[model samples]
Target: MHSSVIATQCTGAVISQRERQTDRDKEIVLQIRGHHIAKLDPLGISSADLDDKDPPELLYSHYAFEEADMDRIFKLPSTTFIGGKEKSLSLREILHRLENAYCRHIGVEFMFINSLEQCNWIRQKLESPGITELTNDEKRLILARLTRATGFEAFLARKWSSEKRFGLEGCEILIPAMKQVIDKSTELGVESIVMGMPHRGRLNVLANVCRKPLEQIFTQFAALESADDGSGDVKYHLGTYIERLNRVTNKNIRLAVVANPSHLEAVDPVVQGKTRAEQFYRGDGEGKKVMSIILHGDAAFAGQGIVYETFHLSDLPDYTTHGTIHIVANNQIGFTTDPRHSRSSPYCTAQPLFTTFTRTRLIHVYTPPSHALTVLSLACYHQSRQPHAISFSESLTLGHPVALIVLDEVCSHM
Candidate 1:
């Protein structure tokens, strides 16, 4: 029915649980909400940099107060009202759900968004704090993708022990999530996708998600031994494109990953420009036929100025690519250095990126891979349902096509 009805019912459900008082978990939930534990225990902390005093919350008494059921609360959002689950849940249950919703493999840092309006828009959109309903087949496919990601990296590590493959060891889910994006895009009638990213998981993305031939990857790795070709970059920096058949629609989908220099974020602008070109070449002036997805390292996405430039570029009349879905790889650590020394913010999702926009709808998604992918799927489906840009009637169209900027600065992304 109405979003207000949904909102009212959701809040009333929470109140009803408090009125009933079924178990200690409900009491723990009340205490947890009072403490605002979700803000206190974010998943962005670098485990490598963690000390004995900073063990993970699940491992220690991370909460301040001591209660009889302190250990009985669920830390994950499995029972939360999110994800389309219809069961009535206790406050503690929803708190656990909130924790996973905000502090899992992805964590949106929109709390720092400058304007109250922008914050409210994001809260209403992606931050509804619930999980999406996923089929068993989709779950199994996601698991298979995860397995493929880890298995491939392990193979490369064993084969080239000393080589810096920049393995997707921790963030294997990235490739799968991206694959989900492409699948979602094609489902939305998007024909071509131009992606750009730094070098951390480029090799994994190249080999696994891009579906580049294994033989080609092996050949490239062998070529990296000698500097004869003078390609100027290593194997991981190399870019490739592959076309896949969208069986249901009987359409051809082209996925292109643009090549980049050693600079962490330089590829962003290039990807946007390239996506715009694809739109023009295809003559889809409404900007619906093409899309862009830029992957970034958490450190670079926050530290670099070019990242900010791309956000501004999208608004310009000549430079706008209609939309782009930004995905920050956010491996947590920048090479060997920890984040505490690199950035001042508590989260890697920087505020300067989109918080300042006056009219644009900013969507921040930072949940774990399973939830992130599901949310992403719903976003694409909604985007597909959004009314197409009508004939030019106003100066500089108010609403651009959908641009989903995914933030996965969570520790579990590892």
Candidate 2:
């Protein structure tokens, strides 16, 4: 009689354990499904546009559901799972956190990430909770740069009403972001960065970030001749090479802003060639010390054939400058032409950098001057010192052109 009763008790305990596990498995499945359905664009759409309203088709069936048993709970997430670390919150709460972190104002398009290892590393960094924080000093530095950029432009508008400074009104944040990029790279032991950009916002970047003197800029407007040999095309197109000490990185960075022709994006390859020459002069056998940075307007980046030609050159074994950073100062409208007429791609960052070349990272972020450094650190933190690409949002104006800041770092093999 005693043996029979003991057997009955054991059977009941097994059934009870199975029922509890079944409920937990159902809950975890729902959360995982929610993660994949998260929104990822800054132009936040209404709830009605949500096509992912229904659960994924696979989760409806018997096999896929049963396969996700309680045994898998203690293990890492599988190929279909879309979560990071285990959390204590309810299923809805966890999904909300995941969406906010990965799919906020900064929309990162990493579908073209080439290596499986790199893709995983980048996803982990971007999805982590601590990715958003920055030190206090970093914030102050960004603010100072923003103030200088805006202050200089405001002064110019008042002082020289007739002169077309091509001011950085919408994209004042570019200055501070560049400041942070240089500082961050300097911290990582990069010695120099060669930058190229269009005439738009040229004056502001020159004066505020490049440390060009205001008096010289004013003098050029007063006495400059027609843009002839392109040596220093009219004052706005004039180029400068200088160095600044970065307190945050405790390193000095040498920067050269190359003069660009009015013909948009004509200087893309020119800057690369110059950067390679500089690397050779410095005896950077591996092209690791010097980085080439080029800024582009959104229209030029996508529509121009020259941009593709320039990208192809980087693929050649002889022509790689380790890596180059490409920033598209994307103000939505490229010149007077609307985006509908100019670009065939959906988002500005959705380009062929990874598909054609296979060695780039493309990230998009909405950056006002206030959030410049914080956004920059988050973009750079995951990449570890490797070359990749990133795009920053310009505060758009209806009548004025919108600039998209595209940053691409060319990768070098050791």
Candidate 3:
């Protein structure tokens, strides 16, 4: 009789334990359902039973809720009931109120809880407004230029091309511009012209403008040693020296582009220094001869503080070079990002900074395949002997001419 009673009690206890577990499971399911419904409704609802001790995994499993769904529940208000009875609310309620306040302040319709904190901070500090309204003309111009240069396509090609490949569109513009500079320098009786630019179309400029032997370039590509001292540089990065007799001016000129490192705009000061030294060596009187021209990327020029530093040195007593002409290849995008994101200012090239020069001028030219304006701009820059900048916006068609000149001196002293 004692054994029978003990067995019966044991069975009853097991049954009661199972029943309690089943009830607990049902309660967890109900809580998750309530959380889901509350999340869907923006009016905000809370449950008092929601405690830190509740097993998140069990509640989520009972309701078949995904991880994301559970996250949403945790973000909801924590009041047990949907009434305004409690003066101070739980963590969820506080968070919901904060979110509502932020959304109202920023005028945003919805808030993403995951990024809410960051968004609020940005809204308050950066004063980030909604999207900008672009004009029809602006849209058309942007599309036209992007299509012409095909900057994206060029970038893709460069990535897969030869190891040290040159950029395409800018190269096309630069080669002719360089040729014009050489031609003009020759015409002006400049015995030597030295140029510097970052790696854009260095290879193209090398092959076409500098007239570097294609065979040497090919050998360099093959990684084969040649009897040339320029094996250290990419075909485009290599410098060249050219001597020519100008048919029009009946003068001889020597031209050389300085080899530069990958540091963009860092070469500006170096070029100026080299030109001044060359002028002094030639024993030329002030502003009579020797000139320096620098080509810059639009995004790099504006985004890099170094460009401003280099520009500030342009008018300095010791660093001046008649004047350094700045040419900006405005691709409207830098690397993979757009201009608006890269620069705070309207223009990517800061031409206005040099306004102190009486002869300083800023010209924006559309690029076309013929590059007539680019050629013309170079001629003007060489003739004027003044500081100038030309910006080539992307709206210009591919193969378009884009160039600017800064002529700070009449002629090279040598």
Candidate 4:
């Protein structure tokens, strides 16, 4: 009788452990499905057509799970899962984290991508808690970069106050944003990057990103004709080529900024052609060695037909440059007209998606210090096989610290 009782007890223990494991798995599956459904954007639907909704939870009644079990699983700060560490959290903490991950300074829209792997990769980066926290060294680097961008603009205003230059006064962070793209691409084995942009911030990019000498840039402002033949173009319309060592990755890379005409977005196709030629010469069958970056203004990107034409050529085997990183500096105003008067759709980035059905990723950065820029850079180089577009919501009338003050005021009003 004693032996039989002991065997029965062992069998009961095994059954109990299996039940617990099954329950945990069910909860995980339900949470994943619910989160995915919640994030899907219903295109062409107005907010008025939708009813008020509560926190999303699985309505499937077959599984027995508590309200606490349905709470989404996120990587909470100070909670280590290593060595079977238990994650114990209150309901409030879980809700707070949910808000932080999806509603913070960085916003991503990638659900339209047909590939499950691509969607999940973007979801993991954005939904993981505490991923936006920056190290002390990174903070210092951002500050230094911002100083260089602002100082360059400030110096121009002081010295050549009367010159007719299209300055990057309010949107200085774009300088560092471009550098981040170059650094990340170089680290990911891209040896050459050809880029094209409008005249708005060309002088600053030539000085900083292409490493053009300050003396050469300043000479353009001087009241004199060019001494060198074929150097007759204006400062911002000029092109640059530099092969230099990228200090961050310890790699030598080639950079070329294609010369653009007065028609701002005409350089879009030129950049693609140059990048494709380079890839062909280098025998980059899969476009692992050469890439391109194209910068667009909010007005030109939405109004220009060439932008649409270039996006359609992305998938053609002969014309494809593997991928291009498009950065749209949206000031929310097209020239002097507001978006309310200009665009029928809400965002400029959505135009290509609606028309061409291009497989692209869209990320919006509301603040300069957010990780969206890094995420955008990484997505382009890591995927290295598809096109990506990222739009920055910046101010035309206000810049950094002042913009912070404006934010505070707007928040107070809210």
Candidate 1 residues 93-172, lDDT tens each?
44454445443333344444345564544444433553354789888888888889878877876777556555654456
lDDT of all predictions, in order shown?
A: 0.54, 0.55, 0.44, 0.60
The candidate that achieves the highest TM-score relative to the unseen native structure = 4
lDDT score for residue 330 of model 4: 60
What TM-score does prediction 2 earn?
A: 0.70
- Supply the global lDDT for candidate 1: 0.54
Poorest stretch of ten by lDDT in candidate 2 = 1-10
Candidate order by lDDT, decreasing, is 4, 2, 1, 3
Error of 2 at 219 (Å): 1.0
Flag regions of model 1 displaced more than 4 Å: 1-106, 109-131, 224-232, 247-250, 358-414
Higher lDDT: candidate 3 or 4?
4
Write one digit per residue (lDDT tens) for candidate 2, span 61-157.
4223232332222222332223445423333333344455444445444444445665556556655665766778778877888888878877877
After superposing candidate 3, which stretches have Cα over 4 Å from the reference?
1-162, 246-250, 352-359, 368-414
lDDT of 3 by residue, 1-414 (tens): 010000000111323556335434533333222222121111111211122233333332433323442223221122122213443333233223333322221211111212444334323331222222357975664455344334432443544453545455432444545555556666655566666777665555555555556676567657787445654765546666666565445777665677777676777777878888888888864534666667777667777777677666665677666655666655444554445556655345443443333223333333311101111111111111111123333322211112221121123222
Q: For candidate 4, lDDT tens digit of each residue in 265-333?
A: 999999999999999999997777888999888768778889888887888889988778888766444
